[model samples]
Target: MTEQEQQTEELRCIGCGSIIQTEDPNGLGYTPKSALEKGKETGELYCQRCFRLRHYNEIAPVSLTDDDFLRLLNQIRDANALIVYVVDVFDFNGSLIPGLHRFVGDNPVLLVGNKEDLLPRSLRRPKLTDWIRQQANIAGLRPIDTVLVSAKKNHQIDHLLDVIEKYRHNRDVYVVGVTNVGKSTLINQIIKQRTGVKELITTSRFPGTTLDKIEIPLDDGHVLVDTPGIIHQEQMAHVLSPKDLKIVAPQKEIKPKTYQLNDGQTLFLGGVARFDYLHGERAGMVAYFDNNLPIHRTKLNNADNFYAKHLGDLLTPPTSDEKNEFPPLERYEFHITEKSDIVFEGLGWITVPAKTTVAAWVPKGVGALVRRAMI
Candidate 1:
């Protein structure tokens, strides 16, 4: 046996089947890998690629396939309780679980929208709440109510509990959603707010954290249940290495920015989203997305060449051929007035430059629908 493997701490790269070492950044490895290896610690093995992608935003990811994601949802779907379906505000498409409504049965589903801080500053709360309700309807989930909260920033978490208390009313509460939707983060925030920062019983991070259902005592003798996260198909998380996911998932409040684009100018939101106003003059195109997503501007004429040369280097997460494996890109066009929120299905949104016409495109299977301007 090799000295490294013999040390009892070896990490395998699930993505490329490479033996991870601590020294390489581009290769499959991380600093933590070696430490764990020497101690023979069997930590969750993610190569440097996945590590950086998960923490930074250098790479784009491939989402999980439908069948695989459904398999993960089996337990929650069969759970005997109320379901709180949490989805990321940035990548609603990546967070959606199809046929979830059918599996809900008599238990009412609560749509918990996480990462509200990633939206543009100008977005009005009432408008956003209304839009969220419509989007949930489109997904065929009649959520008893839609609550927006940022688990990272601890926004509206208390209100979320109040809503839960009122609606759930003395029954089991199952928090469910696809991976990377901040389900774990949301749970942590709720626990911390309801309890305190120093609460000893909370599992703060990682996916499938509550590997099974975890029940916590409630005020009236009911219970708050935490369920394992199910991987949702089409999320960039599956496509990206852990390193790349952190880059795209916003870690803080997003600042909305404005852009001046002429007709046929294309803007790429990393590799995840592309916006082109097919036929318009240089008006304004404002973007409301994760602050981590780097915005690049170029003419539509050179958009293809730019992407070809810069796929992973620039236009990321949709990484090389990530979207091509899926169906064609779905096209959506919208007219602008004073202000608007352009929902890019799972990816997030770009606030439009009012009075400017624009068209946005995303992978086919992933829905790219927009509601009334939420700003």
Candidate 2:
């Protein structure tokens, strides 16, 4: 390498695969100037963000550019690879990456619905798989297969590996998802299960942990590539702090909460989301969210003032960090002619019965949608 080449030579963090640089503190892969210099001699480095996550279980927000993820998708489009598209079963809408069909080209996609451990044990796997396939088809992205696995619990991993092997057929395997979908954890589990190497890649609840794709060689001459998660603006993970995330992101199985609401009643999901029964008869609605998250109910007429007065206190989950940056709640109205789930993007959804009318409120850009009920 020439002197000019040395100056431009890319150095990536071994822990997270982000290209190391010293200029911008807030940019991806930023390290102090002295640390960068020291790393050049030691050959082992972690970005400032990863260092804290590794040591203190703290996550500093550093977003990966959409262009970088797009470039990786473009590269994968031309390769003969098996696309293992991982999605969080709890937050399906927020986990979806739009335009994925255009980028995957002709590759066979294997939809891996992760976080199965968070669901009730009584929930049948076949029903969940059918729902996944239906949602994929509705989004115009068809998968050759759909498998449910809880990467954290290491459940159903061997069966997932068998499915991967059956479809990969001597091609590279690419794992992809929007941020916070447990893609990194799933890949790490796969690595440990297949290669006996535990956690070769860094894992965290934060988005953009893997700034670039990392490839690990397989015994069969094929490789498994872990791509940096695409940052979806609608994902709540982008707006939330680490403490708020712990409260909303369920760590254990979710026990569904059922509420009976009349036409003029409202329910609040922490301080992050709200649901109003705009024009429905007295009915039952089932909510699935983090067990620890607080749920508040009040008359619809009092909701506005209640939220304005007690947002960070009684409503909870706003914490100090998110209180200022949190955008005003935006409403998405729905006239549910059929049974459907009113989804609050990264937050869990409320399943409403047919012939009900409702409106959902979430922070701006944190999406809300209504889909045919998966249950």
Clashes of each: 34, 0
Residues 179-249, candidate 1: write the lDDT tens digits: 66777677767767767743222232233323334456777776676655565545544444455556666
Per-model TM-score versus the true fold: 0.67, 0.92
Candidate of highest TM-score: 2
Deviation in angstroms for 197 in model 2? 2.5
Instruction: Put down candidate 2 lDDT per residue, 1-375, tens digits, no spaces.
Output: 666336525787766788777777888778897887787788657788777787888777656568978897788899899999999988888888898988899999999999988988888889988998999998898899999999999999999999998999999999999889889889889889877877667789878788888888877898888888899889888777778888999899999999988999999999999999999679999999999999999999999999988888898889754677788889999999999999998889999998888999998879999998876
Best by lDDT: 2
Q: Predict model 2's lDDT versus the native.
A: 0.87
Which residues of candidate 1, in runs, are more than 4 Å off?
1-80, 193-210, 219-221, 312-346, 351-371
Model 2 alpha-carbon drift over 4 Å, by segment: 1-11, 21-45, 320-322
Report lDDT (Cα) of residue 222, candidate 1.
Answer: 67
As a TM-score, model 2 comes out at 0.92
